[model samples]
Target chain A: MFERLLFEAPDFFTYYNVIFLLEAAARTLGMTLIGCTVGFIAGLLIAVLRQSVNPWTLPLRVIAIAYVETFRRIPFLVIIFIVLYAIQPLMENASLLTIATIAICLVSTAFLSEIVRAGLESVPKQQIEGARTLNFGAARTLWYVVLPQAWRVILPPAIAFAVMFIKDTSLASHIGVVELTFSGKMFVNRGFSPLLGFGAVLVLYFLLSYPLSRLGTYLEKRLDPSRRS
Target chain B: MTHLDVRDLACSYGSEKILKGVTLSAEKGEVVSLIGPSGSGKSTLLRALVGLTLPSAGEVRVAGKAVDYSSRKSVRELRSQLAIVFQQYNLFQNMTVMRNVTIAPITIKKRPKAEVEALAAELLARVGMEAKHDAYPEELSGGQQQRVAIARALALQPEILLLDEVTSALDPERVNEVLDTIRRLTDEGITMLLVSHEMSFVREVSTRVVMMDDGKVVETGTPSQIFDSPTHERTRDFVGMILKH
Candidate 1:
């Protein structure tokens, strides 16, 4: 099954070669890793800031909500274009990898933030009340008592998002990030056995994303209230 | 000074009043039970005292310091002085009974972990939950959860406790264990405001009983006065309604 790409493809060990494809896969994986790691941190900050219900956090809450809504509503492709255009004035020589990374990071931040917010909401109010009566002020209640429970609810969706985000990283190729899709395009330019070669790209994407989704499914069952006991 | 004081406390959600101009006080060692029909604002009064629901008008003084519920710091200070165990028990589902009891003291009071753990063990023993210290809330029956809830509240070393229907959610067979726990707690000299449907238990344990109707305290007296020979017509009707069943 795996022999065809190495032995028979027109582009095999050629201009659009195995080494190039390997390098491209590395770039795409790197972009996804950066996007998800940074996105999760930024998103958690946004989600926590958004849940705060005091005058001090109101402005931050507004900004967090606006970012999530704005990014979630806009198309990812358009986000890359807009980000490229928006940053052109500030950083005139911005690299494609940089633009693609930022765009994906912001997009994932928006989604990941909402996922966390929903998880926070899913935590029953009783849990929070229990904390409050214990004299744990708002922040401690949220961080120590509430969030640990919320994380069980947050994990599956957050991992599922990773699966979608990995496949979505191929969209980076549209802005010339030289990632997986770009590698496939380079091979397509070689013409012979394009079907088989590009089919390998689809398979590669499936291979990368399938494990994440499977893990997420397993986690969802593991987090089931019945299973928790 | 009274351990807990409420002066003309009134709380409402929107335009609808839950507790209306209710005033009460508890001397240390007093177990004052609030008895009334459902929706009589007994729970609301406890909720107000615990800072779970802020009173729209009136003052709640914990150990004589008037609490400013509008201020988070003030409310936290007040909450530290008076712990509440709710009807649902509300033990942290993610935590074991020991963690549930120990977390508040460590987090809110910043007590040394070793000291808090010692107190947690002691409180669990007081509530007869020593064997189940490692158990989670889901593993326990409602009565056992309420006992843990009591221990958790007690671990805060609050001068007063507010119990809102603590035994109402328990099974018939399980209710006695929780009532026995509360009976022991009253002997510890802590002030307590209890809202309970367990009329016989209330009559047996309460130092004083306050009868409420339609969000107002209709009468307040010794348990025998309130139960055996109530003065107010509303109190009589309320007690009669519950006792007949």
Candidate 2:
């Protein structure tokens, strides 16, 4: 691993290629941003749906549960293949990148929903009563009191899911989206150096996940007033 | 007119009845102390009055208006006029002591921010917690938190305040601080329905004393009438347990 990294060092900062890597990293970041944003919002709605007591909401809840269970149980690559090939006819002229993002978001949303639901449950029942006793109607209670406190608890796990979702963007390379993983694959094929190319992919994945994991830990500690000195 | 009336209130959790046909009343500015052994329905009666728990069969009227559990609006209005302080110090842990006091005023009453803040500061000072304004609930001692809880309850300017053993969770030395605050509120003539085992405080602060056991009010009378003049065997036993302490 060290030998391959040393040999690749001379070519590492070559401007044209560095630009290409930079562009690919940007696309990866974009995928993470778009995917997590859409996924978190959609996941919240689905989680709320799953908890809904209404009879009509039961079928919707079932569909959401089925969606979460289905994607989470299957491999990310398999879901990408199904979305890329089976849904090709539905895309019309839509870009592959957009299609890949949708697939990544759809899958991430399943796991994110469970995290959000658990976060909602972790909030103390007294907090809800505290709001109600203050005459915050149900909507205000949820918006102002419960969700604010729940967000503090939910944030750390949601960040973990975000990092996982970012890493899963690598699977999108199979569909030719030219993300970090795809660029790495192309470099390896051209140079006939699997170790150097994939090593860079490993570094990129670490770079993406490590900061978020650290940030998640930092936030988890910060959000808990009891943990602070 | 009665500021609050609970008529034949009955509440249950699944098969176990927590409150059995409990009837109680409080007039404006009256301090009524409901004393009993543990699990004797005093707390349940207070919770039911605030709609925190729906009674199985009963009526609760606040300031001449009926609280209809079926009507969300009625419950909301009733809740606004009623605030409860718990033995567990149920002030929101995430909020500062001052914010805990100001929450109802700002969020529910829609009072001007300046006015609410001013009143919150005043109430916190009244409870002798003005210095701990910015401190979060976890940072305070149990008695301090209970004082903040009382201030929080008072922020609504409610017609009735239900105190469920507010000092029970405090340390021995801290108990007097909370009790002293309650004593102050009583002196100010706030309408208070207190459930407490602090018989001395009950005798000192309450105009009327109620003895409850096995989910019923065994006796109700002036504190002197009930304390000096015994009525039932159960009441005598309850009085004996507290007086022995």
TM-score of each: 0.95, 0.92
Q: Which stretches of candidate 1 lie over 4 Å from their true place?
A: A1-16
**Candidate number of the best DockQ:** 1
State the lDDT of candidate 2 residue by residue for A1-229, as single tens digits.
6786787777865887778887988899899989888889998888777756667778888888899999889998888888877677986886889889888888878888988898777777878777777787756766776677788778988997888778889888988999999999998887736777777778877887899989999988888634644
lDDT of each residue in B1-245, candidate 1, tens digit only: 88788889999988899988998888888999999889989988888877888789998887778899888889878787788999999999988898899887787688899999999999899889899988988999999999999998888888888899988888899999999999988888888899999999999889999988888989999999998899899888888988999
- Cα lDDT tens digits, model 2, B1-245, are 99888888899988999999888888889999998889898888888888888789988888788789867788888877788998888787767888888877887788898999999899999999989999988888999999999899988897789999988888999999999998988877678999998899899999899889888988999998889887888888879877997
Model 1 TM-score is 0.95
Candidate 2 docking quality: incorrect, acceptable, medium or high: medium
Worst 10 residues of 1 chain A by lDDT: A4-13
TM-score of 2: 0.92
lDDT of 1: 0.86
Q: Which ten residues in a row have the lowest lDDT in candidate 2 chain B?
A: B89-98
- Distance (Å) between predicted and true CA of B144, model 2? 1.4
